[model samples]
Target: MGKDTDIDLMLRFGQGDETAFRSLYMTYRKKIINYCYRFFFDLGTAEELSQEVFMRVYKAGSRYRPEAEFSTWLFKIATHLCLNELRKKRYKNWFVSLDSEEGSVANQLADPSPEILAVMEGRERKKKITSAIRALPGKQRAAVLLREYHGFSYKEIAFQLGQSESSVKALIFRGRDHLKQTLCGEFGEGL
Candidate 1:
């Protein structure tokens, strides 16, 4: 069978086609899951949030408008949901853990060079950087994640976060400055 286009699938799904909705879910699940994973640093929570994101989409399918690209709308929804979760009292202290198993994997993937290992303590440096990112305030962290990690334009981030583009740029600048300070303190000026 031929693959249905995104707009076509979305239109069909809006008309109550379950199969089309499932197809849409299958298409974006990994991206949503990874996005959540990066913020929460917990696999189980990320998986749960991914399911919730799709559930929200399924419920709101009838209201889905095509004014912008489907991805823009989808990311707007995901960003709001993540912000809500971050605001919950239970997660007020949800900082990323440097000693977590996930951190170890990230460290391993970041600096795989044997020569680099010989020149520097790669794993320890990676952990410090990760911890510094986690130490940032939520807005700064979100701005950094969306722009640096997700490759969002400042305008796109402003749309997602309901801020002005200038504000988004400021947040990103502050976040990067904080990261730089933290990394430099831990790994010296060269890092």
Candidate 2:
């Protein structure tokens, strides 16, 4: 069979095509997992949450609306799910331990080759940037993640978050300011 388009694959999956569902799963799995990882800072939890997100998609297939872009819809779901998780964590007084075994700072700092080490250091710096992002209020974090990590335009993020584009911009601005304050000590004046 010829390769199916995303819309066609989604339609087939909605009609109970197992192979089509598998194809969709294979296509977006890594992206979703990475997105979740960036939010939670835990590879295993991200993997589990990614699977859960897909499960939700599978279950909602019959009601899936094509009015919005598929990716926008997918990210809306992911954003809500991650926000809910964060809220629960907050209510439970739980925090992502800095000492978690999954890709901690020490591991990131141990690169051998100088060039690779520099690249790794850059990644670590970005991780710190993201860590400051996580420390923002929920809406700010969501806005920053969607814009910086997913490259979503303000209008798209506003649509996904059901906010005005100006609101999205404000959230992003506040997020950036918070990150700048948190990172200024390390990055110096140019941050």
Candidate 3:
């Protein structure tokens, strides 16, 4: 457990040990869900995507290899699925509705008071950041998330992304630059 036995568990599962697969799934399920959630900012979609990742894991267990850390390989699968889903969404022009006919949660809950206004402003800033990240090209977004959010090393990210280390660096740099410009433009020089 100290040094990541996920590879061992995966190997055991590959040898037809069902409990190893269950243990592996139990260990990484939440991490996978949250990874997907951070990637797309949708709980439902994140859950769905994580399930698909595990499904792929289950199906491919027989052919699993230990070329990298299991987490890195697992995330590579998730990343590819995420990029493909983003491409599909882009083509479909999908949009998630923030409000229903009744009204948005913010509108219904707000009393137009001082404290509520501060909370609303914070939410707005977060929304802006999410929007900026969502606007990034799929690979750039994946690179940034793997490095910044998941604490992945440059080499690990490059391996997970199937890109050279230099390419991963450039993607992260460009992603950060775009976020800085978008957020700073909204927040002014103080940002």
Candidate 4:
């Protein structure tokens, strides 16, 4: 009769309703997995982390509260895990893969276009943007990804990141400015 809300579903799960857990997992599984993928650009690790995220959610069952939205709580858990993993690599080596469909830069630039150089330049631009994003510090990158890629509001990002809205705004602002500088140079058009 009524559409099921995430809060309602979570509450049901907390009550030991297996169907509710299944529904909740199905609803957010792909989203959290993809979100995690953006961090490592690796499907296997992302899948592992996403599975852990759900495990944390399941463990938090009886303690779950609706103080924040379900998405927000879930992402908070995911962000914590991702940040922890990133911190471990802060000074260590990290590399990007070159899978054509999976974000490997070489694969991204490998395809030829009917327009030849023009299409190549367009892909180059995309590659440049990706490089700039990679250059961003993890928190700034996370802020930008949450706000831009995931359609999160500044307020939502702040809530998810445990920061003030002003802080989230500043992070996004700085991150965008860095990207603009990297892509746009002194003039409007990219060099």
- Candidate with best TM-score: 3
Q: Write the per-residue lDDT of candidate 3 for residues 1-191, one digit (tens) a residue.
A: 63268898999999999999999898889889988887788899899999999999999988998898888988999999888888784524544443232235557774677776677777776777777777788889999988887889889999988899999999999998888886788789765
For residue 160, give model 4's deviation from the true position in Å: 1.2
The predicted structure with the larger lDDT, 1 or 3, is: 3
The lDDT ranking, best first, is 3, 4, 2, 1
Of 3 and 4, the candidate ranking higher by TM-score:
3
Using lDDT as the measure, which candidate wins? Answer: 3
Model 3: residues with Cα > 4 Å off, grouped in runs = 89-111, 188-191
For model 2, residues 1-191, the per-residue Cα lDDT tens digits are 23237667777888878898788788788878887787777788788888889999899886766756667777877888877887775524434333334346446665467776676667667766656656777778888888888888898888878899999999999888988898898689987
> What is the number of residue pairs that collide in model 2?
0
Per-model TM values vs. the true structure: 0.76, 0.78, 0.85, 0.79
Error of 1 at 39 (Å): 1.0
Q: What do the candidate models score in CA lDDT, each in turn? A: 0.76, 0.76, 0.83, 0.78
* lDDT minimum window of 10 residues, candidate 2: 91-100
Question: Residue 141 deviation, candidate 4, in Å?
Answer: 0.9
